[model samples]
Target: MKKLYYVVIGLFAFAFIAYLFIKKEPLPTYNVDRYYIEGKENEILAKFLLAKDSSVIELDEGHFLLGQSLILDGVNNVTIRGKGIHKTVLSFKGQNKGAEGIRISNAQNITLENLTVEDAKGDNIKVMDTKGIIIRNVQSSWVGKVSEKNGAYAFYPVLCENVTIDGCISIGASDAGIYVGQSQEVTISNNTVFYNVAGIESENSTNVKIFGNEVYENTGGILVFDLPGLTRYGKNIEVFNNKIYNNNIKNYAPEGSIVGQTPSGTGALVLATENVHFHDNVFTNNKTTSIALSSYLLIYEMGKRDAEEEKSPDELGNGVASADKLNDEFLKDKKYNPYNRKIKIGVNSYSNSRWFPTLNNDFGKLLLFKKPFQTIDILWDGVVSPNTDYTICIDNTKDINFYNADLLNDFKNATTNESLYKCR
Candidate 1:
């Protein structure tokens, strides 16, 4: 019996050791490269800072622990390349000086390809006021558990023109993974984004195209928003042929941020943007709704209103006067449009089983209060401008289940009258 017990204990210990060995991720093999930089972090940073126009900086296959951000300012036609996405890693886990991992400002014709940047204090890659930028085959992420202390954006481009981000992988951002704001002529295609608050976001931009992306497991899949105090308004956007599903991750954005208001289980939320189109995208397993078209008033006024200060349905007459007053006060700038107009949804595939809505924030609670029975596929907060011709046009009404939550009427006359919102 003693001999048998000793054999059993030895076998169990050996099995446990083998399991741990198999579970560990193997490191990539490094090839000898004389031309690539394979030294300390300061050496690599110096090469980037001193790079001239039309120069190329190649990184070797190794992990670099960086403490400060790398800046490429006022340089034109620069290219930064690496051995492979998994081979060359730049980690800012102990970052102490700068906010971003890489910052490119006031440059033109910059290209970054084939690398991984992880765990920055702020955004991983922030390109501002640049023209003709290309980011291809790059990966940006935050390691370990997802938290609000992670970076806000992975690939962030703002106030730029002629931007293209293709074949990139982004993960674990507290805010949007791939974000383009106040930029024109942007194309974001062939990317994979997940485990962020919002996977992909286009805010206050024009002439944008988002296609051929797989976006999943975020708080919200995609967002097209026009905020109150921005330099430009969002318009002329197109989203097609993407796979957006299962975006039910809990929102981890910090308090008082605009994206903190986003509810989990939301697939797409279009807020106060015009001339937007959605076609040929596949939506699946979004627990709350597939698509929601909302006015900024719904988020700013009604969503922000304290729940303790409740008004009876009888006290609010049609709810138009309160809404109008709030709109006038919010849209005082006269340049920002507060209503969604000329939006079209055509031929998009939707597959979502009925599930409970999220109760993390006030907006989700409001959605649950409005429709307590089951989930929704397409929801429109029925708030339109009387001055302009606003319409939510759908091509195939029979295939989609639509709900018009009469937010302006305080849910008094909420209906599924799809014919009333037919394409004109």
Candidate 2:
């Protein structure tokens, strides 16, 4: 019995020592507010040589090919600092390109400053479920292209709050240049975003402020959207004092867009967002529509839409309602995304002020003249085929049946019609 007791006691002692080594991290300790992380060589990911603590991790300048992965996990109160912005790169471009440029998950009170990243197959910078994060004076250039699965956006914050992005530059991203989703109290200011689908976009985010951004030359700039099927809603957006112009470029708009060439992440589209305000921005020289807002926010564009064009001159209401009706039929149970390929243009879309010249060419002639642009296609069930004459039935009541002259005439019929509804 005495010998057995000693054996058990010895085993317990060994296990306790093992726990201390495995669980305890190196450097700066847990939750230490101050520390520096440096890369030992340009050819290796020296900054990620060991498990990092919650302190500030400083990376050295020049190209770094990480032999392994650097994970800054649930560590809170951290800062990832490096040399000049766009100076240091983490290139997993070789055989093993990992998940993100700097994948930050579930950490709060973090600051990423004075750094540049490239060649990350996934999101260049991804922050998830984090709060009170700040990204200042940072640049991420040439994040992956759109052809591959992960080669997408430069910065994407999913499920975060109290975020601020200031004085940052992002270029050549497959998705929106800088994006945020499902967050509150967010601010994106003084950033230069270009060569992306949509410059700066937010979805299902509330109390958001996007100001002082030089968002230009992309397909579209500064888009705030909540279409359908997204698990959330977006409202209370304030856009002011920025140069939002020349976003209407030629060719099809990039991905995540809704208008130009099937509404890629094209310029400044707002949907179903309420209590929004846009003022003092220079919107000009864009190839496509300047600002495509919900029918409710049509007042926001003021004089941009010709008074005669808002309502169709046809027998029914404006064409958008027909487009909506057709959209419900085509997409079926899928939440209607105006950016989707079909049903993008309003019925009699050729006459709306937002209509483009090419729309009146071949495809436009077919749609407007009923000429059959190719095979007329429709959606019945979850399949795509040609169905010309089926009546659209909405399983979900969200669809609007406002066809032809319905929206504009009904909206202002009190003045346009004769009899008791005459304008004063």
Candidate 3:
């Protein structure tokens, strides 16, 4: 009787397992939606039009003049899907004036999916003044960067808003891999942008977010800049969860030129902007600082001499702002360049080092530059303080050349406060 009960329980368990197995769905061998289209189609393999001369547009493979700039205009409520990237093609054989693979303007509810745009003398995809824009599984590559020499063209969007960019790949761009300028409420996420002068750039826009993007190996990765007097102020930008690495690119362009190479040498930079958030981003292995924070420094650096008080306040907050001019009469009042600016690394007591003395190999802190800087000050004592002896006096009676000057100048201009008290 006990053995019969045990067999009954085992059979019930087996029957339940078999029922669950029969109810399960098979795992898909493949998802056709994820497949990339390939190969050529009939005709010259030019542009494919959607809903020719209708409010609703649907595309098939054929040589068609696409977008509003071409045969048709006002593409409203359009669903433009490709048969496959291989089946359809955009022939920009003689697109001399700002030709794009798809030039969308003044449209609504626009959807572009599963397309490959190549040989765009300009931008592969250009959207303007559109609402509800969606670009999925899109790949775009330009012939090269177009400047005055090659005609001003790029895979770019200018003066559009409420944009969403995802799962996109852009390469070999002249200006930027992904360029979003003067747009509002935009999101550029999960995109691989590479091999361009500027990786991903947002200029003079607001309420924008850049999240989870791989921006690498560009001349400069992710620049947020406001051109002087452009009338566009970059505000409320958030850059987070992005890997920005190796963003230094050489600029042989002549000084005082903006077009050739984008300025602000940084892996990521925030310049003269406000309400910007930089969080959880990996910035490493760059020529300049991983991130540069600079604002209102220019007003102090280059304010006019006459309006010094108006521009820069004195220590007492009085009108005597020309202490800078007074310094010229007393001592050279020139600002020290970054090379001579005493680079320090790490915190004090824990880890800190002075650059002129030696490679300290630590982060900078307040304790590093508290004393009157002297070469012997760094040599005898690691740092200078009131009680410490001026060690430079023991080494050389004439001068301790501090700032890497030429030997001729060093001998003529050697300074000793004690011996040369009357020289001043």
Candidate 4:
């Protein structure tokens, strides 16, 4: 008994020592004020917010009414957080000079969390030319009903890399509620979006994973597009495990906007993109085509834009070819392929919905004229690549019907051949 007692005591001592060795250190605390009233004396909030590296800027639990925008430029290793999403609100309803409510540019290692921004002239929160960005628990919107006068995008991140947008809410965006463009290595998850033209959009971006998002009551639930005028093309995207429903909002985007072309009640649209996979999503009551596979044929110069349009090397080129070289020697123009490729649609649940898509636009008119007999579940453009051994694959969605508009052939005919796309 004495020997066993000693052994037990030794074991407890060893465990305590191990716990001490493996325990995490306590996080550092700062002595700064939560209200951050440092630069309010001059009424210049931008001066107080010019954060340095390794800085934590916290907004107190209060409403900040600003006439001008808040700009965070060229900052690194900084965190801008609020007391809570509902507790801290930034209203730019009176903004007349600035284009956005909060604009962060040329930033790295930046974090924005627990804040609400609303009613700016342009995007509510725009992050550009950034790397290592994290946005969480943010709400952005317009105060009134959705209209073209509202900002284009609610939570907009373009020309960024390594971005993560989670636990966000958006409403009343004229264009996209959450728009990520010309970005790479992005993950957009756990968000709720409504009352927007396109609820969630990924344009000219690559290596994106959009999952666990709830999108409803928007003009279009989700869109993956590769529009012209961008240097990069979209590819390698995965959308899964999302709730897309009731996206029958009328399209109210301003004329000439890319989203203005999106017809009302569209559940999801994949246009002029590549290597996209959709799986395990719930679709119901969308009131339009549940899922559409299309090309830029209608948008990109009536589908006749040269696939090899060249671009000059500006300062912000894609870094494929060096910009320092003289004009003629290193001017290797990258070929732009606008055709959709390697699309896999699988295992998605669809209901008795989207049978009567709203006839609100020219596309809707054309669709109605071509195939007025029945509503479609999945609408493919019927634009095939020249080197195709069935670039599109569909699996596990046997209950739903399919339609091939053959849009490129002047919308002359349609077909419902499940064998044509069963390459998966």
lDDT of each: 0.82, 0.52, 0.46, 0.76
Question: Which residue pairs does candidate 4 place in steric collision?
Answer: none
Off by over 4 Å in 4: 1-48, 301-334, 353-355, 362-374, 411-413
Candidate maximizing TM-score? 1
Query: For model 1, what is the alpha-carbon lDDT of residue 149?
Result: 81
Predicted candidate 4, C-alpha RMSD: 20.8
- Count of backbone clashes, every candidate in sequence: 0, 18, 11, 0
lDDT of 3 by residue, 234-324 (tens): 6677788888765544322222123223332346644444455655676655433354433323322332332354434333111111323
lDDT of 1 by residue, 1-424 (tens): 9999999999999688546422333211112222223448888899888999999988878778888999999999999998878788888878999999999999999999999988899999999999999999999998877887888899999999999999999999888999999999999999999988899999989999999999999889999987766677779999999999989877777644667667777899998898999999999988778898988867666533622265433333222113323334466766777889888887799987654455555555666667775677788888876666656888767767778887877888788777777777
Candidate 4 C-alpha lDDT tens digits along 1-424: 9999999999999688546433442311112112322334223364436668887877777666677788888889888888877688777777877889889999898999998887898889999999999999999988765667888889899999999999999988888999999999999999999888899999989999999999998889999987655668789999999999988767777644557667676789998788899999998876557788876544444312222243232431222112222122212433555567888888898874333445554555555556563455687888776654555788864777687777667657667776667754
Model 1, backbone clash pairs (residues 3+ apart or across chains), number: 0
lDDT (C-alpha) at residue 338 in model 3: 9
Better of 1 and 4 by lDDT: 1
Angstrom error at residue 245, model 1: 0.3
Candidates sorted by TM-score, descending order? 1, 4, 2, 3
Better TM-score candidate (2, 4): 4
Cα-based RMSD of the predictions, in order? Answer: 11.9, 24.7, 23.6, 20.8
**Residue pairs of candidate 1 with colliding backbone atoms:** none
